[model samples]
Target: MPKLETRLTRTFNLQYPILSAPMAFAAGGRLAAAVSRKGGLGIIGGGYGDPAWLEEQFALAQGVPVGVGFITWSLRKSPSMLTDVLKHRPVAVMLSFGDPRPFVDEIRAAGARIICQCQNMGHIMDAADIGADVIVAQGSEAGGHGAVRGTMTLVPEAADYIRATAPDSILVAAGGIADGRGLAAALMLGAEGVLMGTRFWASSDSLVHDGHRAALLEADGDGTIRTQVADIARQIAWPIEFTARIRQNAFTRRWHGHEDALRKEAATVGPIYRKGFAEGDAEQTGVFFGEAAGLIHSIESVDTLIEQINQQALDCLAGPATRLTSDRP
Candidate 1:
């Protein structure tokens, strides 16, 4: 009913400048298709390059035009997975947490737009240097793995850098953006759109465990902390510079400040962690989300959530001008 168009909308041919983040193990085919069907682009998370899982999710999308995202560093271990995904003719390919340059040519050759998710100015410059079609400025407030920069400062700075260097590359904002207020703020900060993770992770269509979703609803912004505990427990070997943000629980309380200790006990703890994760034990497993957890109170369908956000953003954008008058003192 309400529309706000920007470079991102035009470039992606979408009704709204919204893209659902490809959260690992959570954003699945159903979630991706739901977002896409609602006029926003959705990306299935191809975390750690599981060929079988990727194929299954693609099949579940049921012919909907959706994209796929990968943990770039993990993708390096099985570069052939990219080749396989390209065969599906994904509308876009998103690379995050590693150098996207190595796979740029192949993605472009496949006729899919390239979206590089960058954590800092260097990453932004690198993405632009390689002629990325879309650049997402992802801040530390984002769920899962990310570097230390905050979204507020990183986004406008990224916008300026992209404009001066690669004018054709459009910018999107990520990290702690869950609702229409955040979408409106991103537009003001020079982002053409917002790429959301935690919000979508809580959507009914997402693949998050019921316990994890329950934890998300109960969490406030302060309840989350950045740590290496989950990665250590899962033995993910993420780059040292990036840490994951997850809800603080008994597991984190015990392991957050003791990385070496966690490593020492990983053999004993890892299996327990895996079991907890599989069983949806929120206290023992990592409830991955961001500060936006505080903003989200309910789990709704992707289409309903998108429609509400779009209309709320339109209202917020128009309200400031209408409520302000020269006669006001």
Candidate 2:
């Protein structure tokens, strides 16, 4: 057995330590089910806690043991929404971008594991205080709404923090993790596994447009830019401290520097944004991706991508240090 397989076989209840990050709009039933069926943990991005959309995706899952993830602060608006989702009995409840303390009891009472996504040590400690079963350290390289800390530093920092204070807690690294190299590096950085978004968003199962997937396949890391204007235009209020990483297009280029103006124009631009999504225009719509876009060459099936990553990780782990040379002996 390869060392990677041995090390990553059961990081959690998952057969593979790989996890598909809950990307709103892009990651839906097909993507989540595909990853879950392929031995990794899949999570439906319950973005803003839309019960209808979540219910539709749950039906689409068709018996796949998947969980649901939500934007924490957004869920705060409707506290009862959590209770509603809990009725479905998700494997876990993933909360990000806010204090997770308020809903911990409800999630626990429902017999669901709690996975908290954090941007820094402060939030990680807070999640630990809330008794999170798993803590996901989402670095700045991630797509969607994210903080400004880079993955290279955040993973190890989080790992060290947990080891010293809450050694029992499991840590997963997010942001810019696309390939086996990234996975191997994350493990080396002391993460038990990785939460991948950009890589999977380019996969065939993802709900994103073919043109968007194609663009992701061709884009290098430098092609992505982080901005808050898109969310503002959509009236998706996010904390000022966090920004969304998206493909830099004409719309982003125009508004990235002028958030106030974008807010003023949001009423008119909101419909335009939705229309752009329908029309598949990059300039008008937004495509989310992290720095890992540089590693994407083509969009493959979710299972194939998982296998490729797993094999690469195995090869990396079973290197010279673990190899036993029978011929030399």
Candidate 3:
């Protein structure tokens, strides 16, 4: 099999050029550690700087070179958590949903590469300014918060800009990439690797609610919608330009385009939303996933998913002529 060798693999010292996205409340220590143990880098979701949660997940990711990702705007409020995260000496410190500039120097001093997840081309320049080792070009199709650009155009565009300005910077593609074909396509688009979230969110090791996982399996690409309904219902103060792609449910339908209405009804809706999450009520809550939800038909182990992606990429790269004719001879 061809090694998934690239700047990503070399930088993280991973066998497969994959990063298990640190999806908040979804990817915890077990999932991250599992991916890391199996040759890919695993990233714990340190969403909003929950100290106790972060501590528990870090403990669970004991043996692996686990990294941690944070929503930058949220992380700013709890800067001490960054120090706590670095104490573990992760392979990389991933930041998304806001500016990563303030944390770059501290992350480097702690001996971890900076992985800046950018939702727009403008953010890519900000990351480069901070000398980020890796820039994850996350398009609008991604499950979580993202900007308007699509992955197809944005990945290569960012790659070209980075190559011209920061030759040593590595580029990774995110958003809507879930399978082997996606991985292969990313490489061809000038990215050295991929940041996987939705696919891994349905994995066995993921901390996702069982109800959410079941619903995700039933959902296709069309089943998801990009909107701020969930954020509004849950009262998360996300950036105005970024929207989350989540599986359609009653909650989304009830408040889809009515952001103002949701806000007006926050007192009543917020409690219900929190209850739905606590109870795993699919109808009452939305499941965060991407357009790649179409590619995910079954819930499998991370090991199985990673191996499948690796094999698929190898086959795709080899082509039928090399795969079939060589075996015949």
Candidate 4:
């Protein structure tokens, strides 16, 4: 594989400029460790903050250097979770879906890099203001919760903002990025690296259910829809601006546009949604994934996935120069 180095790699001492999104419930210790072992950074999803689950995942990492990510708004409910997790000495701590300022000082004091996932220019500015070590420009095309803005435009905009403001902060692109093509495109868009979710969610190392994995393989970009139905059904109480991009299923079909109705019926429907998710009923529950689902066809180990993505990105980055030279002759 060709060498692909960037500020992110240098700052993190990583061999690849790739980081796995800390997808809630799915990105566990095994997956994060596998990615770290494979040269990329893996982030265990700390999702709604079950202290026991978080501890268990960390144990699964077994001392490998890995980070942990959390839904920022959710993290507010359990401030102590951050203090507790800091004890494990994570390489980094990623915050998304809410203001990161409150916890920035603490994360920094703990000697861990602070990564803030931003959904728009406003969010980017806020992250920069808080002195985030890394800022991920998360587009709406990403799986899980995010606001409007496409990756292509958002990344460059964030890059410009960071250059003019927080020069020390590393910019990473996320959403609709599944393979080497996306990685190459991200770098060209002025980001130092890429943050992937759906691709890794489908990998063998991930804690994804078999049913969800099968659905992901069969899905196309069009199969995903950004909707509040999943959160509503699960009673997560995400902010108004954010919506989750998940595979459209029977449950979504019935509630996508009828969020108010779903909310009203949460007492009745919430249990069903939770049951479906627990049972791995693909059609009945939300299969959280992004537009990149179309790009994934198989479930491979994290090692194979990262190796292929790195090589392919290097090839893609070099293709234009090779073709231009050939044409000039």
On residues 64-88, what C-alpha lDDT tens digit does candidate 2 reach at each position? 8888898899999988778987888
Give the lDDT ranking, best first.
1, 4, 3, 2
lDDT of 4 by residue, 268-326 (tens): 99898888888889988899999998888888899988888887788788876542211
Off-target runs (Cα >4 Å) in candidate 1 are 321-329
Identify the leading candidate in terms of lDDT. Answer: 1
Q: What lDDT would each prediction earn against the true structure? A: 0.92, 0.84, 0.88, 0.91
**C-alpha lDDT (0 to 100) for residue 160 of candidate 2:** 88
Model 1 lDDT per residue over 76-162, tens place: 999999999999999999999999988999999999999999999999999999999999999999988899999999999999999
Clashing pairs in 3: none
The better candidate by lDDT, 1 or 2, is 1
Candidate 3 residue spans exceeding 4 A from truth:
321-329
Model 4: lDDT equals 0.91
- Which of candidates 1 and 2 is the stronger one according to TM-score? 1
Off by over 4 Å in 2: 1-11, 320-329
TM-scores vs. true structure, each candidate: 0.97, 0.93, 0.96, 0.96
